[model samples]
Target chain A: MYFLAIGLIYLAVGGDPAGIVALLMASGLGGLIAGFAWHFGRRYGTRVEDLQDSDAPDATGVVGVYPTASLRPIALAFGTTLLVLGVPIGSWMSMIGAAIVASQVLLLVHDTDD
Target chain B: MTTIDRKPSAPTVTLGGDDPNHLVSIDSVIGPSGQEGTGLPTTLVGWLTTTNHKALGVAYFVASLTFLAIGGGLAGIIRAELTSPGQQVVSEQVYNQVFTIHGSVMVFLFAVPFGFGLANYIMPLQIGAPDLAFPRLNAFSFWLYVIGGAVMLFGFAADGGAAPFGWFAYPPLSGASGSPGLGADMWIVAIILTGTSGTLTAVNVIATITMLRTPGMTLFRMPILTWNLLVTAFMVLVVFPVLSGALLMLLADRQFGTKFYVPTDGGSPILWQHLFWFFGHPEVYIVALPFFGVVTEIFPVFARRPVFGYKGLIFATLTIGALSTSVWAHHMFVTGEVVVTFFALTSSLIAIPTGVKVFNWMGSMYGGAITFEAPMKFAIGFLVTFVVGGVTGVMLASPTLDFQLSDSFFVVAHFHYVMGGTVVIALFAGIYFWWPKVTGRMLSERLATWHFWLLMIGFNMTFFFMHLLGREGMPRRVPDYEPISNWELWNQLATAGYVILLISMVPFLIAVVKSLRGPANAGADPWNAYSLEWATTSPPVEHNFEWIPPIRSERPVFDFRWINHDDVGAPGVAEAWMAREGLDDRWLPLAGPVAADVADDANAASSADSDVG
Candidate 1:
């Protein structure tokens, strides 16, 4: 927001299109702040700063632990990297990336019950 | 809940025992009824997928060290190229890429990531949190950093190797026209990814610090390092978005044909400068603030004094962070695009807050029981070297001097003094200070002292003369300079200094390796330090702590010692108060030699434990 205002000030006084990056940054961070603020505020409320109100110093105590040891994230990383690189690399790589991503998402959401 | 045995006399801080200063009740958080945390899995897969903050911290530490080695190797190449005069090493093109990659790696991979790793390991522990607010996100952030690093380095395997336009990768030069190489594009994508990783981590860190502190640990009571990192996270939140936003536009112009920087397209290259430096100036502080935090913590412990002006230091840190954003244009003094007056003024304003921190540190050691331990030795070195950096920095803040020295080795020397000198030195200090706690072992002080002297002498030898060389008008980023330029002797001396730096690092490395292989006997609170992290086991449990002593002051361990022993602190305070109040010290125990006495006792305990073993 500070950078945004500066860029606009610089441009209004003939500094030229510093506005492009500034506007992009403002939007990116604005959205992030809004999302994060809402989530953090709703979730923690005023309890965030009250260290005394927190649970005991139990290392093993936790609120939640999701399922673990899956290959989905690895596949996701691979596919995402490949897809990004494919933009300047080749269309064939992009196809492979797209395919891998689709399959990985399928495998990811599949329940472990079976 | 394990019981850490203190000296037979010093009251033991046990898990279930009733400690008078116990801040939080065990029944509320650590009693028998609380369920065991989803403890770490035994398998490598579990280690890989685990959200344990400590594991992630270690992963970061190891990865960042590897990156430093790689970056250091690149620096070696650049040094080789500039050894005496002629380009004795690689060609000019490779030279460009080498230096660029060196800067990019050092900035993105080495300093910042290393800080993150240390903070990740220590912050949650210091704040007495079970884990970061979002653990899965923490793991994800770590992996993203790893992948980002991998992608950046992977650019070397490409046809053109890596980007030659430098880390900032300025427009026109970095665009499709100036250097048409896939390496540059790869640099763009890699930087974007790295930036993304940092941003995500910043979000996690900010949320963790703000929302996850244990009860009783108020903002004022947070450890200096946590406070420093908290400020750093906010700076990251504000500044990195600018870098990412700028890089994205630069990327479009490079790969997708949007002229955000092409002059013909009404896009000034200066736009890149503005955006980059806006992020870049605050970015160095993002790197340095952790150094400040570490030194701040180390000085107080080694000096046996409360940090002078705790609130003053916090306000100074916030001031520096705010002022850091305004001074970006100081870097642009030569560019002629910025309001020189505004930048110069803001740039000079930074010194006021920075001076407050410096005075606070010096004052912290004054009138206190100061010990020159390995960590303290390094911190003192930071003060000496960083002062030179800071003073020279104020000189550069003047646009007149900047015009003369902007592209010279002078700026190089300044940053190396401040950035490499302070950040790296403070990092060594942090590593030494925390090693006992982190690894459940202590580094060899004998080897550590060797590392320190070699580094100090060599670092000063290398950079101190660069100021001279810069004053003589030696240019930076050059593969070679003519002998007629009268720079040969100074350049050789500078080159020798780099050699010394490399040599000094050997003992440092040896010390680390030796400790990892040595005994795991560093009991918790080896330094008997004050932070909440020290209240736990040396290598803290799977989560962090089993039970924390109540937070009475910023220095919890120190306060606990005072409450329990009364020999080291309370009597001393009482004596001062009595003298000030014109009363007798009749009721108080003798004001014993504080740190030395405790240190002797701790040493005796350590020796006895060894004898038993």
Candidate 2:
């Protein structure tokens, strides 16, 4: 919402298109957050957080299912490093990076299903 | 309030019990731990793939400290060269690379990540959350940072050395025609990766804080540090991507024949400033606020008082974050294209909130039982030096003054005062305060005292003279300077201060090594601090806390201890207080032996008091 306001103000002031784009990008991020909040608020309505008089222990217990460990993040990082490095180096390197990224992403999705 | 006077029926949970070492695993209480799996084995591979926030935080600390050493070495070279005027230490080209890499490495690799690292380790603990909302994403962000930083440093060994156009990398200097080297491209790639890493981390922080806070840990009940971090993450989310975008445009101009910053080819060089400073100005607060949070946390613990005007501090932080975005044009005033008055107004307005924070810290410490531990010492150093920096910052906000001091050592002096003087100094305070908590060993007080005094003297001596040098029209970013009246003396003094500053790290290093070599004697709650982090053991176990006390206020741990009358050695007092406060029914079956011992102690204490009367 703040980002949206800033973007509108910049537009009103006849700011640069590039500057406006940046502000709009920020607004998009803000919207994403708002959307997430709305979705979660509806899904898990009136949590202890919403109740002012709630006790701390009421919020305790398993918060969420957190990943204990995963190797896909490392693979993803490696692929990204290679992909970015290829930008300055060569197209062949980029091709290999893209291949690794595609394979690892597939494996990640499969892992989630299992 | 919903009347809880009627004892609500619920299963009782005992806190610390008779066994003394009875660890209360939340997993045990809340059913299956959900930890059993054929996931990555607990080995080197497990560490590599670790999504644990604490482990990743340690990695951040180690990596950032290494970069700090590298950056400090480059600074040593720059100071040594400028010690006697003419370029006696290295060639002008080397000098340029030195300062450029120094600035880039310090700002990008060291300062920003250091804050994130602290946040990673401590923020979750403070908020009573078990872990960040997206642990896998957090691990990915850490790896990205590590890889990105390594790639950036790899530029030093490139054919044409590293990018020498300064940290901001303003074009046409950073353009293909100007740099024409792979080093510049590598720097851009590295920044893009790190910027992405920062943005993702910001998302994770925001998500964790918003969604994962322990029940009863309402937003307002949160510690000041958490509030500051929330604001900092918001700023990072907004600005870092903008920086990434600008960098990408610069890369395109170099590689894809785009003219985003090519002034000769229908591009505006000033556009780069607008884009960069738009991110750059808030980037200052991005680094500073965490440390500001650090000192705010420290002041209260040592002074033994709640933060003065806690809500006011939060409001001030929000105000500063909002105003920082608008004041970026102040940096571009000399370009003769900006609305100087508007920027000047916004820039000066920022000082009011910052001033409110200073008063809050002072008010926190005004009449409390203040202790000048190593943390307090460095925090005091932060207070005195940050005021100087703040005053100079306000002075520079004026367009007329900024025009005069533009590109001068005064500008250099001003930022260093804020960044190095406040941020770095407060970082030391945090290191000292939290070292025991992190390492489970106490740093030697004697060594810490030496470290504090040496650094304080050296830092002030070094940057203070630069202000005078700037006033006398000594330009910054130059390899050599003509030996004018007192210019030589100022340079000599500054260099001498640098040497002292360099030497001061010795004791700190020694203290770290010595403490680590010793036993883990620093118990949990070493200073009896108020925050939730101190509630757990020093170097908390895998799941953090065994049991968190009821958080009725921001200082839950303090309240717990107060109810127990732990200072009076009265154990049963906690039960009595809980019963009186109508909390007994909620958490009964109070540790039997411990309760008995407490009851005995309370009786003994009462009798002793009566006898004295």
In order of appearance, the predictions have TM-scores of 0.84, 0.87
Which digits, one per residue and each the tens of the lDDT, describe model 2 over residues B340-450? 766788799999999999999999999999999999999989999999999999999998899999999999999999999767899999999988878779999999999
DockQ of predictions, in order shown: 0.19, 0.34
Candidate 1 lDDT, B1-613, residue by residue in tens? 1111111111133422476444322222222312243244567887677667787787788888889889989988987787787878899999999989999998898889888897778898888765666665677677767777787787778888888888878888998899788888778777776777777788888877776666556788898889989888878887887888888888788778998899998988988888898889989999999889999999999998888999999999998987787678788888777778767887999999999999999999999999888999999999998899999999999999999998899988998899887777888898899998888799989998999999888888778888888899888888878885558777777778889989999898898899999997777777868888886666776666555554545776665445434454423322322232211111111112342344455457768988999
In order, what is each prediction's RMSD in angstroms?
10.2, 8.9
Residues A3-114, candidate 2: write the lDDT tens digits: 6776677677666676677667877876776788899889998776545555543332223345657787778877887888788778787788788889877887677522
Q: Second chain only: TM-score per model?
A: 0.87, 0.87
Highest DockQ against the true fold, candidate: 2
> Worst lDDT window (10 residues) for model 1 chain B?
B582-591
List candidate 2 stretches off by more than 4 Å. A1-28, A56-64, A112-114, B1-46, B564-613
Q: What TM-score does model 2 score on chain A?
A: 0.71
